[model samples]
Target: MATTPAPATKPLHLVYTVTNIQHKVRMLDGTKVSYSSWVKLFQLHAKGYKVMSHTDGTQSPAKTDTEYEAWAEIDAIVLQWIYGTLSDDLLVRVLVTESTAYEAWSRIKAIFLNNKGSRVAALEHEFNNLTLKSMSSLEAYCQKLKELGSQLNDVDCPVNDQQLVLQLVRGLPAEYDIITSYINQILPTWETACSMLELEHHR
Candidate 1:
């Protein structure tokens, strides 16, 4: 008869301050580190952060202040609170209104990459001028998108813009449900229009 397996050892509970935890996670064998090392990860986890471990962490992506993911992470954290998993603390405050602002800005970024030339620049301008006071409802976002679409009609498409847009939208954050909702509603229209335009221009 096989002997009973030895009692399993309890997993370690390591205490960590909110600060410096990110550094610890970046160290050796750190992926296996406990939750508290970066409690923020757990908080994000609850809110559905899909891009935790980048593909081959060895190849560092540019960590620029202007990088969309940096701002996206903030939106994700705020979304957690909006969804009620995270509590707003003095140190980790997240305002829903601010998160909504970024949501619109990210959508503008999406439109910019999908189109080309002066249209992208025009979208960048419009997004820069988007005021919190002006866009009080989701309808405002839809109107903004329509306004951008008309502007795109005036610009020439880049050679690879279609492929680039497909890849970028495909890779966008899944937790931004509202964005995804609008995407689902609009992507079919985008594909049909772009495909027809490409065929006309090439043929």
Candidate 2:
């Protein structure tokens, strides 16, 4: 089988016409616990457009390579995509005059990785302290707990299904005391726990 080589100029490709990417994906808020999801969304976007290599260094061509200039151009575009999606604080920290897409990407990643310990502690504390009284409603309590649990998992400090179920049962208002005690007797998944609580609320 014969294969046609790619164009020598990067921007000539139709996929290089990316703009307003910041509007497409949520910007990177430096203090957010949802950093992993944001990273996932950006990677998915980059992969769909055939530009993952510009950020991951998987297909990097050296300065002396024939495709080097084109690669650099594509990389710069990818860098701009990242810059556009970053919060002002984050952009200021990672931006460099001559940085490659991979350099900026890795530096930002390092920043999150280095703070994982503190993030884990803070999220865990908040999750543990969360209760139905603190939220607007039963649904809100569940939603916030789930968000915190997911965020903790993203930071590599996961709370297991059992723990989530337990925590959900633990935070109910006084009216839920009887149902909460009943729920505590069983080993339900988090979804089941939420459903049981809802059933109790309606009854």
Candidate 3:
């Protein structure tokens, strides 16, 4: 009986085209903008291979022929995707060179993730200094405050509801004395405080 040979597997590069990536994950630029989204996209694309640990060449046992081959293919694909997304300057600066995908991933994460503390501190400083000018629209001011608060929360330094409300009330100009007094008395949530301020602004 003649048995049919198994079909050859397609090359990983052809299987996953760079163009097919709806949102390409770029190298980490200084700005953290779109970083979370990029990380999510890369994780989704590199599922099953993204978190694999890199061998140290001494501590780890030698990989079997099949295992080595599989790792090589996946490593090439992952590196290609990562390199493709990087800016030319960044690619030149942080070139992964002979490092495995895991090493590259770790290095990139360390570069960006290490500055989280400074980021949180900067956001807190911004929140402290933010003020609602007399001429500023109440709605716009509130939106800016909320946006800053959201950014703080993203970095795991979220301002509590009570503190946020207090901050908002305190940041108001002297012209909003009556509304501020009313809000402070009740110690309302930030949303309620914003609403009250909005009403006062409209009046």
Candidate number with the higher TM-score (1 or 2): 2
C-alpha lDDT of all candidate models, in order? 0.38, 0.82, 0.66
- Ordered from best to worst lDDT, the candidate numbers read 2, 3, 1
State every prediction's TM-score relative to the real structure.
0.21, 0.75, 0.53
Mark the regions of model 2 whose C-alpha exceeds 4 Å error after superposition: 1-14, 30-33, 182-203
Candidate 2, poorest ten consecutive residues by summed lDDT: 10-19
lDDT of 2 by residue, 48-82 (tens): 88888777768587799998987887888888898
lDDT of 2: 0.82
Give per-residue CA lDDT, model 1, range 63-127, as digits (tens).
Answer: 56465555455444433332232222311332334544334323323433444666557654664
Sort every candidate by TM-score, greatest first: 2, 3, 1
TM-score of model 3 relative to the true fold?
A: 0.53
**Best TM-score among the predictions, by candidate number:** 2
How many clashes (backbone N, Cα, C below 3 Å) per candidate? 0, 0, 0
- Model 1 regions lying over 4 Å from their true place: 1-120, 124-134, 157-187, 190-203
**Residue 199, candidate 3: how far off, in angstroms?**
8.2
| Worst lDDT 10-window in candidate 3 | 51-60
Residue 44 error, candidate 2, Å? 1.8
